[model samples]
Target chain A: MRQNIITRFVLISLAAGLLSACSPVRDIRFRAHYHDANDLLYAAAQESDLPYLKAHLKDGGIVLFSESWDVDMQKEIVTGDGQHFDFNRRFVRDGEMVVSVDSVVIFETNKMPKNNDQSRISSLSVLGGLNTALGIYCLAVPKACFGSCPTFYLDGDQEFHYARAEGFSNAIAPGLEYTDIDALNIYTTTGGTFPLTMKNEAYETHNVRSLKLLAVPREEDQRVYHTQDDKFYLARQRVELTSARSGNDDVTYLLNKDDQTEYFSLADPDNLRSTEEVFLQFDNPGNIQQLGLVAGFRQSLMTTYLLYNAFDHMGNLYGDLLATVSIAEDDAPTIADVLYEQLGGISAYLRNSHKNEWVYQGTWYETGPIAINHQLMLLDAAHPEEEIHIKLEMNRGMWRLDYLHLTEIIEKVVPLEIQAERVYANKKHDEDLLQIMLDGDAYLVSQPGDTYRFEFELPAIHDDYELFLSATGFYMVWGREEWQKEKDLYSLYMMRHHPGRYLKKHAQAYKEYEKVMEEAFWGSRVKHQIISGHDK
Target chain B: MINKQVLLVLLMLLLAVSCSVPRGLPAPEELPYETKGTAFYVKLHDGSVYRGELIAAENDALYVLPAENQHPNMKRQSGVVQIPWDAVDNYRVYYAHGKSLVWFVPVYTIVTFSHGWFAFLTMPFNLIATLTAHFTSQHEHVLRKKDIAPEELGLFARFPQGIPTDVALQDII
Candidate 1:
């Protein structure tokens, strides 16, 4: 018994030592190039000279590598699907990338928020006399649609119209991905070389490419769908399978142009009204039993507030939200529009009348898309000759389309383990807020949330003072009261400061810049005070 | 009972932690009891001294627009001094009562009445608080000055005495 105890104790000690060795933290003094353990490598470097990662380098931890490049954002467009576009920058320095730690590479897009400004006369109700007068004035002055809006076609047959290009039309090149270094997510790569590739092959031939490389299965992509009211609607050539599935159960695939993968996108009417109609047509395969829909949804209150008021000066409040998905078959009577009241909207609005005073705030939901199956064979056992029609419509709400599916096969879906690779580090205050700020160690990890926390050593100055924590995520900080309904983390912000490289140059213009900071802080505080019922 | 005790302890800990983060300035009063204008003095890292009326205070810096008329010795160049908080070695603030009662009484009366009759009931407390702020501010500044070392005094070192007495001091905010 005594011998066995001695052996077990030895084994435990060895295991503990191994665990400590595998930890990412290592003494900076032990850097491969450094010779002396007692010498402080950062002692000679001025605070201004030190980059963020180097200045905040902990005694025994890995530091993130930071670099910056100027990105020309003029009329730039980014593809919606998340994937890494190749940057194609060749590095001369050659070293084996050992354990790809966190990285922060900032890009200076310098792009302003999308302007939501509209002519005041446009806000008048359509029936009001002012609207008619404004229309006459616009017609007399210049063509209302001159270079602003143009007619377009959806397909060869259907006519599509838009007030303006649906959204900003900047396109990112294939192979380039924007990380917005200022809002970088800290990631811990599990012991790997740089640029590791991860592919999730759920089906034998259907492999999905995720933005981040991992050695695990990918999360199901969010599919967006739209619907019209309770009538049977159908359109020809609605879906075409790019790749045929192994088993034939009267099922076909629709491809996603963004991801270049198979999916079933519903036919969108664009206009969300009872009078407007959308139709989809697919060749009838034999013996269809059931139809499935993979639907995706996310909502943000801030975005909803902005998008809802984008067209109107102050038209409608929360009462303006209602949407539905309506489907039908070959003019056979309509199904009641399935209500979708949980979808989110987005917009960019100026906090003040000043055009440049835009502040963006909104929420993105994580409740993934669900698969809903409806019994198709129950309606008519043998209606193969009849073409199927589907319609999607909404009253006044906004949502993205996922996918629509028609299938005879039904199988229980096995939930795959999807590990979230992105997380924002947010630290809470303890008994001593100042001390907590000084420690620079404690932090909480939040995923699918934007709030991030950082701690720095307080300068031992003679006067009591505060410094701004400058970084590049969402620039505007939402007050606690303004976002009370949002259960996610709220970011802590000081006065806004210039970016790292521009700090010195900005200080030269400090006299004028100080006024801007004063106004921003005062504006924030006054707004908070009024909203919190302490108007005085 | 055990769970309740644990929860109570946790709540106390949270309260203690929450109380530590500094709540900036007290809320503005419904009645303007403050009769004086806010005064400010700052010593910069580059050994410059600015003494004048406070223009603005923010997390980034304290701004002081030079007082227009002051003792020749105390007057500074005509421009706002933006002392970045990190560059400030020492600073002081006080209330200067210039022509207090002239505009103070009228503004206070109009604002208080506008708020409602109940606002009148709180006038006494506001008055006491304002008085306390005025009388004790300079003394507090003197105490805080001890933290500044002689080398960090900058232009303030030349003026061993307090602000010059040539100009008549009045606080009219």
Candidate 2:
């Protein structure tokens, strides 16, 4: 079905292109010439240069060509059978008319030019046709259009999937604004001026209050990771998995890299909360005192679909729902909590060889589908000799795991914070906005199509360091016009009041839009270009 | 697969660029006089203007077939108008080059969608290119009384070789 839909879309686009090749209208051309009365009289007097003319007289009558009419050049007079008219160009009578050559004022032609150009018309037709087709596509599937929060990029990467960080995705309202940190995966830099570009490529408006870089110093072969509780850890001696199996299939190769080639599964048809386990085995690095399992992963579109469904149900009342959440107390349970709890997260467990049983380690979870988030799951006092066996149990089809590795923990460390020294808004340096960012009180509101470049001077330390982006902001999703027609306040109520029941009831609807929505969402990713210099 | 898509896009771009050249109007010498009638707007000294096709010029007077009948109900009407040199004020003839800026809207919209999220950057660039094309293209040209001699415009008349004695004006214009 998915293949058929894609094929249909391509065929329609081709038809539109072909239809646009034909010009819709013919070009009209006009050629005009003018002559003064004196010029006409002078030319008329010259025997050798008598002007060929189509002439009209408005001396209160109409003049028609008659065989009997004659013009005597010597007498400079013309006599013809014609009609007379008032000064208003109205015709009065048709009779013998005589007029002197000196009485004429003006003589001109009123010929309409013929259509002569075909190339230009054809070009216009193609442009117009393509535009019409694109407009129809946008109208039909607005949900597929590019939309998200502020996305950050490093110097070299241009692809959307490789974005270094995405800021404040969960902060949908002003009151829900908070800071988010993501590892840049850059373990070493030359320690000079560092430039990071922030772009609002989506329809949402981003209110960025602050942006800074968190630099954590680490030795060679060591990587830094942050836990769910926001504790930074320096780890070394990373070990790749010997074998990884999800059910009966080996997925070791898929989870080998931080690249976007992810391993994902379809959601359980019967139940969304149904669990699946991936068993992992890695060569044990002797008896290490402290250990951490590093996992780079992100949620699948299941979460995004649910969020969009909830928003669609809220529809016109979405603003009110956001307002309620914004005004709620810090400790109060919100809809986000309910949804997260209902679906659950990836839980890590280790096998105790002596007891031959799986012991609980830890679980790490974050919401969003754009950026791949990394977290460390610390094991509790487990020292393995021969091999390390770990099991990751997660809701089926709820997550996409990109990279998984077991690392030996070095120690807990603090990040050295470096604030942006200069800020460029839409390629123009704004000193005032930079000051506001430093103050952390005012926000730099970015509308759609806005881009910001944050320049930070790296710390003076010489050792290699890991870089992470710390951005504080919240974004408001622009309500789509199509969603207004799908207002279901009762469904919104069910989602907020009884999420467990809501999930089961809404599963079928999500299933319908899942494939198309995913295709559209990824295909419509916003592309940005960074100019070499700050001035653009 | 990606290479084929890229090649297709490149081909389309090449086609668009090749056709984007602004077309110029045909020169007066190249104007097709035999196949088409040249229209003229004649303004008399009394401020009345008449539009028609030139029929013939003979013996210091000009004969024309007026485009419209001002008094269709009048009896005993002649189908051609005769004006001596002294009754004229000034006359003008023009040639309209077929070019329109209306296509810019759709072209820009298509470009925006094609660029996807990068439209913000490409939109401004597209606007500049469109405006440049519009301003540089010739739309129309007007030849005034001083621009060309009266005898020259006579070449565009309905019967430039002079009216045939046996033919009626209704059969020609």
Candidate lDDT (C-alpha), each: 0.24, 0.65
Per-residue accuracy of model 1 over B1-173 as CA lDDT, tens digit each? 43355456445533433322112211222101121124556777878777665544545655565555543465333345556778887775432211111232233333333221122222322232222222222132221345433332221111112122331122112
Q: Candidate 2 — what's its lDDT?
A: 0.65
Candidate 1 lDDT score relative to the true structure: 0.24
DockQ of each: 0.01, 0.06
Q: Can you tell me which runs of candidate 2 are displaced by over 4 Å?
A: A1-144, A519-536, B1-12, B15-173
- Candidate 1 local lDDT, A310-426, one digit each (tens): 212212221121111112123321110011222222121212223334333222222111111111111222334444433333222222222333433232222211222332123
Report the number of the highest-TM-score candidate: 2
Chain B TM-score, all predictions listed: 0.34, 0.51
Model 2 earns a TM-score of 0.60
Please name the candidate that would achieve the greatest DockQ relative to the true structure. Answer: 2
Docking class of 2: incorrect
lDDT of 1 at A379: 22
Q: Residue by residue across B1-173, what tens digits does model 2's lDDT show?
A: 44356456545544554533223334433343223335566777877666665666555666666666743552324666667767888976543343555467456745676545435333443443344333223223445577656776655554443454555544544
